[model samples]
Target chain A: MRNRQKTEKDTPLGAEAAQRRHRAVLVILAAALILCLLLSFTLGRYPVPLRELLGILAAKLGLPVEPFWTRQMELAVWNIRLPRVLLSVLVGASLAAAGAGFQGVFQNPMASPDVLGASAGAGFGAALALLLDLSNSLVTLLAFGMSLLTVALVFLIGRYVKGDRLVGLVLSGIIIGSLCQSATSFIKLVADPTNKLPQITYWLMGSLSGASWRDVRLAVLPMLLGLALLLLSRWQINVLTMGDDEARSLGVNAPRVRARIILCSTLLTASAVSVSGMIGWVGLVIPHMMRRIAGSDYRYLMGASVLGGGIFLLAVDNLSRTVSESGIPIGILTAFIGAPFFIWLITGRVDHYDG
Target chain B: MTVEVEHLAFAYDEKPVLTDVSFTAREGQFLSILGPNGAGKSTLFRCILGLQTKYTGSVRIGGTDTKTLSPREMAGLVAYIPQSSRPTFNYSVFDIVLMGASRKLSPFRAPSREDNERCRWALEKVGISHLAQRCFHRLSGGEQQLVMIARALMQDAPVLMMDEPTANLDYGNQLLVMRQAKALTKEGYTVIQTTHAPEQSYLFSDRILALSGGRIIQDGPPAEVLTGETVETLYGISVRVVSLENDKMRVCMPINII
Candidate 1:
């Protein structure tokens, strides 16, 4: 059992130094996110120049700057691109943070924001709203309410199950999620093939198209509340990763902490999905990538996931708007890009997860 | 802190796991509970730690009833070291040990500079200061056990309860961990650990509580409680307890049965 002992010099940095390093990494991620935001402002179809974009932003902020940009340019920035871009960032950060939180709370590597069926329920809600020919705002409202209701149902069923609580919750999620998918399929079968069918399909594919300031306002409360709570609960979440019994020994009330985490994650997932229909892969992939960069401490991991996720989805959304005349759905791009990368990550380093 | 128990009876559903179990461990006392695989040693430790509270008994730590205490108060009175197991994520050893400071803080507070200093002190106490930054999963079984002991030290409680701390270690590492447990007692910490090896209790424990089938068979000093008859009663094995000539240490050897 005796390996050659290393001197202090041979060891890595101390705990404080390592924490400082992780903070630096988070700062770097934030900077990258700002860069993506800047680049996204200029990359759309209307082609707003960098200077004019800044001028419009300054005018919007009520600064003492001259309006060198045209009214059309102002409309493009304020009406179309700004809401879409801002919504992408909010949705991305929410999904990623929620994903990271769920993974940690469940202590399962494959756990994502949709583990409790929030996304599936939101998807079904949106599809039903479309079939009934509801307005856009109503669609979002129904989706949000439905998502919360789905998770609440999952909890009720989970409480009645026989085995481990986490396991019961997961199994209930699968069962409820499949039921929602089947309902969505039935709605698709009954809707108008040319109009409602296409709308439901595109919405389920997940997109930030037609994003408005209202969508942002509606999603902000729940998402911000969830994100802030999750961030504050980071230390408790770390204690929880040691397992229920160990957490109890450390004076942590594991059940209450777990309930708080689940509530926050559900809020985040529901808000994000209600805004942007059922976007997959960002929640699962971004946090996994952040683990490699930020090292698994939730203090850094949550922040890194938020920034990294915003940058990733914003970049992908930019590509979606610019890559074609009609723009690809954001979800399609995330899955296309995320699946192979996830496989590579799992295969590239076997030790990243416990076998 | 002195641990006191009275009529500690526990059962899972309809089956009884511990029956009428009671013992007192005083300050600076190294107590070992020796039992076989199916014995109620672990269940008894669980009751004392407050992890399993469905038992019909009273457990008082330092004169405070455990049922009257919150989990945080219970943790302040006693720290537990579970058998080493791999975590899902590969957190660093420093992070793992730092978690022990949770017992003293509010739910939302992270470890502070003072907590970090305490972690460093705990690591140094276990002689693994250089391994703080290393990944916990990469460490050897013995090193992991030391890391856990260091975590328990970080809890800074007067009482330490270990459930088979050296269950997965080799021979030398077993003695190494036992020596550390014994040393903790000298520092005025009440060390209570459960072990399957009679020799471990014979060597390091000030008091031995031999448990079998949900009951205590014997409770006394090592020399008085670790007789051959006690070993046979605990493990259902015929063993000879021999005292070394020079070191005056007692060791048990099982007899060959045809």
Candidate 2:
């Protein structure tokens, strides 16, 4: 007489509580992202007041608001700080989302956009443009194109190696990443020691100081499309995290789905790097942290990664301006901040390797 | 459910693995495929599951050709339990069982109401519903095998295909799995299992199909085909079949290696 309708297993009480924790973490990160977006407006060198920032935002959203801000204050807030803040959130979220996707596809805990050579290739392209003294738009275009091309090279190499595609991809990515990194270093060596060298060096170190409305427009569509594709692939990714044979038994085409995921992740990483230079560790560290916060299920991890990444970079960008008047490079800040946080994660880790 | 294979032949890069292999099993019948290593037992299972499609001849389930069924459609008719290989992900047992319903699930969505119900039913059928909240990798070998069984049941296919279902387990767990698999037949499931244990064939299966060197070397009821001479020839070793408990049970043990 076993009435099996409502066994304790039916509800999975422990997993549901874990799921609740994951959802709460996501909600908190999203709320923090919004708060960071609003708070970032009140920061900067020229000092636009919080009230003026709000009035300008309301006016921009097409809401009627009293003109508490002067034209100079409005211009500084609207044309200057707004684009930088928007671009930072967009680029941060894109990199973090792409990193999570790439980690799933590669089936490795250490994977990131930089692991695939996207960020390095984009860095070389930006340095080449600066060496040629090209326009900002041309630098962005070259960086984006070269990043895509570098990943394509990795993909081609992976196809030829012929056993265990994920391993092959990681190998090819390391090779191509080193090659692109050396090329960037070579460009830096040959440039003029005074002007172009410093600019190239600073760009390589990563900064969001010169962001504009045009840069945001150029990167937005591709980044959004990449995020949408990764979000849609979450369930399949859960299946894919099991090995290829298991995925096949479940009627999933592992290679084709893996390719689609790779394409989306590459597009996101490339676009983000082209706009913001090599903002390292946001891609590497954010996804790892999110995996800890939101369990291994990609459904919870992907959304949390996107929002958490935005909040992280938004907070860091604010720190860049606030820690000093001249402002530190965001890449250096990320490394200095990311490395210790990674050590903390390792010390507290519970050895949850997939197998 | 009825499974029919007619002149099924397959080769990998011209090295023939299976040729002229055929069998038929009807509803509630248990067919045990007995073979040594490299006897094409797994290749045959792959061909039936539609994982290897370039083979010649036809595999039919319920009189419908396997070729006409897409992988999703094929999954609706046949389910497989692979030999125990440690999975690489730490997915919970519930999520792993729910994955058996993946063919019907849309991409990027949570499990539907029916999916959850099926998962619960499969867990209860395997009598391991209490383990649903635990991580799959944390389970013991026998429990992991049973979890996979629950997953296959969630597929709700009429025909169940298992490759060496009791390959690596203790004696008690082995009998536990064998008993559960045998019990499914009474519920009108056609179970196709490959096992190295001739005793399992003698004790549990309704029919025995012995394969060697890519062909059906012997086929009949276990009492008729599993003799001392035939068992020796099949395994390339001296073996003895002993009856125990007043002629109600039999056991096969190799007396020598080659």
Candidate 3:
């Protein structure tokens, strides 16, 4: 018995090895995200060299490196390229992490940030702002507020409806989301087709163009808070997937944990959609890909989704700006790219989407 | 540890389920609850587990009222092992077992190194250490049941409450689970299981409680309680209580089949 105890204390072989593999996968994902970050800085309209980019990064961090880059390069890198790239990364990470959280909380593989209608509601908020010719910051603020309001409405309606609580919440989201969609349609119908119509339509299509540092500042706090809370409560998500009765038996307060997850995910989705204007498939597709890569232990899956999302959106955002003289809307590009990639992932792999 | 339930009556919106049920189980005793489908066995278990608080009566564990205990305290008193079912996500067996330690942790805290050690020890005790890295959904039904047993062990509770632990297993697997439960009783842990199988209780349980229509009809040693008449009354199926190997073992066989 003493010998067996010593052996067990050394960490059993199979599970330790598997954990090491999962850790390696997370490390690889982080490395890839860093690489994409560096690449995004250099691949914009006014190309910056790798050396100049490094110098500017060092200078920005208050290192003693001298700037060899021109003033035009500095302005492009710091002002235009920096905020857009950072916002894309932040928005991408938030959406994907929120998607993963929603999927776990709902115990459904197809669940995403939009599953609760945050995106649809934010779209309506942004449309109304555009039609009213509100300031850009007001558009973002209103979108964030209205997005949260929509989910609150869903939860309120869900409380009164009968049957399964999860089904009720999803049904309410669907109903309210369509309601917001038609409202946006009415806004479009009344606006001038020459100017206001095009503006509202472009905002709904989702873009990162003209993203300023102020926009990044506006979104950073809520996005970071949501991500931090989700990461802290990561293991609870795994417990919840066993179903509420089992979770309760395991000593977790299922309803409380579920509420925290939904609130955090809503914060993430609302903030991301408000700034980026309804970027869709990053939340849906990146998490599924991360599940294939990291396996489904939420401890690792949550971090993987965050990093995987940043890499995917950073890469896609680069493509959006540089692929043509006129930048394509990110929402259009995400669906255009995400759909076929998702199909290939599902078909090429012998995996099922139970979670 | 001792469990005492007194005058436990429960109703769902005016429809009575379990009525005036009372029982006591001490440590190291293997208690089997035999009842027909919809006999309120599940509702009784739910009340004891503190999942249903609407029941009228007192449930005490280790002489403390269960009503006053927090969920974490309740988990520390008794661990629940549900019948094997596939989860939505295919979590690794180690991760699933580690979750049993959540009661000892705060909501935001992950399992510590000590918790992981306990989890490994529990898996080894359950003789499924080899499956620690395997995905839960990929395991066989018997193996899944053992995994759940390991999880309960990781809970480090004094009593283990199982909901039909061997319900869907084959004959060999059923015996395997029963032997494990019996062994737990020998280790001085209270083992309470609910099942429809009378012969299983006859072979393994130290005491049997026969429940019919939300009431306890009989409670005693298996030999005193699992008679031919009691079996017929519980299940409404006539059966012959057959003795094997000089009454060393008992088996129930149904009679009057068309």
True contacts kept of each: 0.65, 0.39, 0.54
Higher-scoring candidate on lDDT, 1 or 2: 1
What are the per-model DockQ values? 0.57, 0.42, 0.48
lDDT of 3 by residue, A101-155 (tens): 9999999989999988899999999999999999999999999999999999998
Which stretches of model 2 miss by more than 4 angstroms? Answer: A1-21, A44-49, A351-355, B85-87, B246-248, B256-258
Worst 10 residues of 2 chain A by lDDT: A1-10
Specify the CAPRI tier of model 1.
medium
Query: lDDT per prediction?
Result: 0.89, 0.84, 0.89
RMSD, candidate 3, Å: 3.5
lDDT per residue, candidate 1, A293-325, as tens digits? Answer: 888888899989999999999999999999987
In terms of lDDT, model 2 sits at: 0.84
Model 2 per-residue lDDT tens digits across residues B117-157: 78878998999988776768777888888988898888788
True-structure lDDT of candidate 1 = 0.89
User: TM-score, chain A, per candidate?
Assistant: 0.95, 0.93, 0.95
Count of clashes, each model? 0, 0, 0
